[model samples]
Every structure is written in structure tokens, then in C-alpha cells.
Target: MLTPEEWAIVALSLRVSGVAMAVTLPVAFGLAYLLSRGRFPGRSLVDAVVHLPLVLPPVVTGWLLLLAFGRNGPVGGWLEAAFGVSVIFRWTGAAIAAGIMALPLMVRAIRLSIDAVDRRLEGAARTLGAGPWRTFATITLPLCLPGVLAGLVLGFARSIGEFGATITFVSNIPGETRTLPIAIYSALQIPGNDDAVWRLAGLSVALSLAALVVSEWLARRGQDDRAGHVL
Candidate 1:
């Protein structure tokens, strides 16, 4: 017997994760493009920092976010002063934490795809009177759709399961920051809620598996579409 609150938590988790992925995709793609195609100083350092969250413990990432985005912290203070808003202990904050954790995976996937794209195709587009942005939009982007889809799906799935960073930064307040992972954690904390935990855990597993399947399907479909375009 699932309560309304639990179901709400599940829906909210999906929403937050979806939004996080949506928010991360463009930024990831742009960064990936820059890393793949742009020749710039400090590029290596930028790449390293982008992947830092992937290597660091989620809790540590959360702590860094807290330090940087907390009310008294510099950037956080500026944001608050400028917008009269706060991210700490909020749903938005949880999404940001999850997004940071998932960004490296997203960027890596997009970067690889971009790298694999045929540069000659882009050059051909330039020869046909296309600007850099036009070539990217028409040729590079279409060819790399599979990787972009993969990155989006991966980031969304990761965001769904986000726990340590979210809890550390957002504090797991029920109905606000209590996402699916937080809900599962809360369920396990109760002595007689093993069945509930099992149910939610099953749901979580199903969601993750579904996301994986969707990613694969989208990747394959993108490949097929590209192949057809070539034909």
C-alpha cells in the first residue's frame, strides 16, 4: 500500500531528474564542442575540473557546493542578493548537486561523439557557404546526436539516484528535497518498513533499467538516422 506522499516523491524525483538533464544537456554539448574542436590554453585544466565531480565522492562534492553556495559564501551571497533566492535545502539545490555529479559523464559522452564526427563533412559545409555555427548545427550536431542522447539519458538516470550530494546539500527535507533516493533512505530507517523499502527499491531498479534501455534505443536510432542521411 503506497501512500500518496510516496508516490508524489516518485513523481517529483522524475521531474527533478528530467529537469536536471534538460538543464545539463546544452551546457554539456557546448562544453564538449569546445573541448573537442576549440584550441585554447587551459583547455586541459578545464577538462580536468569538469571531470572532478565524477571522481570525487558525492558527499565531498555536496560539501564544496555548500561552501560555495551557502548564504554567506561569495557566489551564493551574490545570487541571493541579486535574486533574493537560495538553493540550500531546496529542490532546485538538489537538482544542481545531481547535475554537477552527472556533468562529467554527459560531457565525456558528447565529447567522444563530437571527436568521432567526420571533420571533412564540416569542412564541406564550410565550403558550401556555411559559417562555423552553421556547420556545427547542420553537420556536426546531427552526426553526434547519438552521444548527446546517451549523455542526456545517463545524466537523468544518475540524477534520479542521486543521494549523497543531494542529502548533504539539501538536507532531505520531506516533500521538498525528499526525492526517490531520499524516500528510500527514509523507508529503510523505519523498523517495520522493509516491505515498503523493497517496493520502492524495486521501482528504483525498474526506473534505472528503463532509462538504460531508452538510452540504448535512442543511440541506435540516432545511428540509424545518420546512416540513412548518408545513404
Candidate 2:
């Protein structure tokens, strides 16, 4: 039985992870499409930049985010001054941190999916008088859906599990930025809190498995959809 506080932690984590997924999906999809299909200048550079967060230490990435989005940081300052919106040490900050941390996984999954798409199908659609956008929507997009599903699920899982970047960027404030991992850590720091830790760990495991199961289902459904389309 999760205490109210524990439930709150779970709720906050879900909110943050959901926001992270929603915000990153379009951007990740765009990047995946560009890297997989479009040939342009600085392509390699863009790829490296997109995957930099994956290679960098979580702390380093978080620190960079802080420097770029902190209250006094340039972008953060401008947002606050213009729209009066603040992300520093706020729930939005957690979302941003989670988004950046999960982006590489999302982009990688989506990119691979896009890469696996058969260009012949796209070409055939174009030959049938389909424009670029029309062909992509009818052929390429549908074919790459499994990968998109995989990326979205992976991103959601990563966001839920994110600790280092989120904590560093937003600090663990109760009912605000304290997610499951943060809650578990807090329990460990307290004496005779092993039960709480175990429960939280169990929840994490369950959440991960749920995400994977959902992803698998979607991937299979996508395969069926594509098969029916082929028929």
C-alpha cells in the first residue's frame, strides 16, 4: 500500500514523463526523418549534437541545461521576462530535463524505423502522382510506425526513470519535483525505511514492464496494419 506521499510521487512522475514524451515526440520524429531521409549540410554535425546527451554524463547534461535554462540564464531569463513563465526548480524544469535525457533514445528508435522503410514504396507512391508530403503520409509514415511507437515508449520509460538530470535541474522538492527515483533515494537516506524502498522499487519494475508491453503491442499492431495495407 503506497502512502499518500508515495502516491503523490508516482503521480508527479507520471505527469513529468507524459509531458516529456509529448514535447519530445514531434521534435524527435522530425530529427529522425531528417537524419534518415534528408541529405543536407552539417548532417553529421546535427546527428552528433542530437545524440550528445546520450554520450555525456547525466550530471554534465544537467549542468548544461541549468546554465542554459536557469532563472538567470539567457533563455530562461527571456522566457520569464516575456511570458512570466519559470522552469527553474519547477515541474516544467523536470519535464525539460526528462525530455533532453530521453531524446537520444527516442531519436535513435525513430531513426532506425525510418531507415528500415523501403524507399521503393515511397517511389511508387510518388510515381502514382503523390507529392512528397502525400507520399510520406501514405507510405513512409505508416511503414515506420513501429519504430515511432518504440521510440515513444522508450522515451516515456527513460523519462520515468530519469533521476540525475532531473534532480540536478529541478532539485527534489516534495509534490513538485520528487519523482519515484527521488522518493526512493529519500527513503534510503532515512533509517528503517527498507520497506518503503522495496515498494518503490517494485513500482518501478512494474512501470517498466508495462511500458515495454505497451510498446510491443503497438509494434505488433503496426505490423498488422501495414500488412493489411499491403493486401
Instruction: Give candidate 1's root-mean-square deviation (CA, Å).
Output: 1.8
All models: lDDT?
0.88, 0.90
Q: After superposing candidate 1 on the true structure, give the runs of residues whose Cα lies further than 4 Å from its correct spot.
A: 222-231
**Candidate number of the best lDDT:** 2
In model 2, which regions exceed 4 Å deviation?
216-231
Candidate 2 achieves a global lDDT of: 0.90
In Å, residue 47's CA in model 2 sits off its true spot by 0.9
Pairs of residues at least 3 apart in sequence or in different chains that clash in candidate 1: none
For residues 1-231, what per-residue lDDT tens digits would candidate 1 score against the true structure? 667887989988987787788888889998998999889999999999999998899889999999989999987899899999999998888888888888998999888888878788888899999999998789988889988988888888888999999999889788889999899999888899888898889889999999899888877876676566564
Give per-candidate clash totals.
0, 0
What RMSD does each model have against the real structure? 1.8, 2.0
Native-to-model Cα distance after best TM-score fit, residue 49 in candidate 1, in Å = 0.7
Q: Give the TM-score of candidate 2.
A: 0.93
Tens digits of per-residue lDDT, candidate 2, 20-69, equal 89999999999999999889999999999999989898988989999988
